[model samples]
Target: MATPTPPVVPHQGRRRASGALEGEVLAALQRAGAPLTPREVQATLSGELTYSTVVTILSRLHGKEVLTRTPRGRAYAYAPLTDEAGLAARRMHKVLDGRADREVVLTRFADGLNDEDAALLRRLLTGAVPGPW
Candidate 1:
């Protein structure tokens, strides 16, 4: 009987900031106003990152529905389905909605903000007041 080979194990450690790369790629696409191949993204990153790594990240992001890709010759050009802000808002909403008490969740969210952020949020909610507080 032939011996079976063991399955390969994935690297375990701090996970890659795949979300950040997706955001960056999306921003680059928005700036370019067109689809970009992995090579293009690698060139844009310059010496800060490796081409193959960027390609892998792009492929993973594309699989995650964070990005859309179109075949261009032997390679694919990828673009983001939504902007970073929209993606972040969707994720935040998902997290908040999963809670049992939405009111408490929102209250805690407000309370977690820094003083400046809280004040700014209050101002936005109440609109601009001409007089000083």
Candidate 2:
């Protein structure tokens, strides 16, 4: 009797991120106010990614706490845990908090500021009185 043939299976491995795709996905999620399924996210992404690829990216971001997911039947609805600005602030705080010379670090940061930003900083500093409010 002829031996039965085994069905071919696709290899499963880690998917490496493309910078453009990652940025596009993140931007889409940021623009959306509610959780989005993989299909919905892919649809808003201008068809730049496959459904599976989108799922993989979402899963990776979810693992990193960059995004949160809620169960919806057999799939998940994903949303950004924090906005870009919030994420940046969190990262900046994490880095700055670990430094030995926070004041020097802040001074360097202030020194590096552009004219408009420096002017804004000056205004903010001048507007704040030491008292309470």
Candidate 3:
């Protein structure tokens, strides 16, 4: 019999990804419910991220239109374009829009759904139910 693999453990002092911080920043903005400067974002993270790193991540997300930024003095203030569900919906729409065959892609997606999932999707599409967290 093959030996079972050990569970992976995160290493200490490994370089954490900027994408991880981006989620944190997005959550912070959502929680704040207002635009925030990079310094404010860094502060919200409680010094876990450096000022410059946070600035770069914010700028990158803004470039992707995931976050909106407006000039605040010398730097910029950032806010999320939507809540988590809205963001996910936007991404799905973007992917569908990019593909030439919307019918085929949507057919495949709908065909893969279970009965319960299909019902939920119908309710969601008709705005008869709230979105998932």
Candidate maximizing TM-score: 3
Per-residue lDDT of candidate 1, residues 18-109 (tens digit): 66776676677767767899888877766455788788888887776777899999999988877667677777888997999999999999
Error of 3 at 123 (Å): 4.0
| Clash totals, every prediction | 0, 0, 0
Error of 1 at 78 (Å): 0.7
Candidate 3, which ten residues in sequence have the lowest lDDT sum?
A: 10-19
Per-residue lDDT of model 3, residues 73-92, tens digit only = 99889999999989888989
Give per-residue CA lDDT, model 2, range 5-96, as digits (tens): 99999997765557666667888988998999999999997886799999988988787678889999899999988888887777789889
The 10-residue segment with the lowest total lDDT in model 1: 124-133
Give the 10-residue window scoring lowest on summed lDDT in candidate 2.
124-133
Question: Number of the top candidate by lDDT?
Answer: 3
TM-score of each: 0.58, 0.67, 0.79
Query: What's model 2's lDDT at 42?
Result: 95
Ranking by lDDT: 3, 2, 1
The residue pairs that clash in candidate 2, if any, are: none
Deviation (Å) of 65 in candidate 2: 2.1
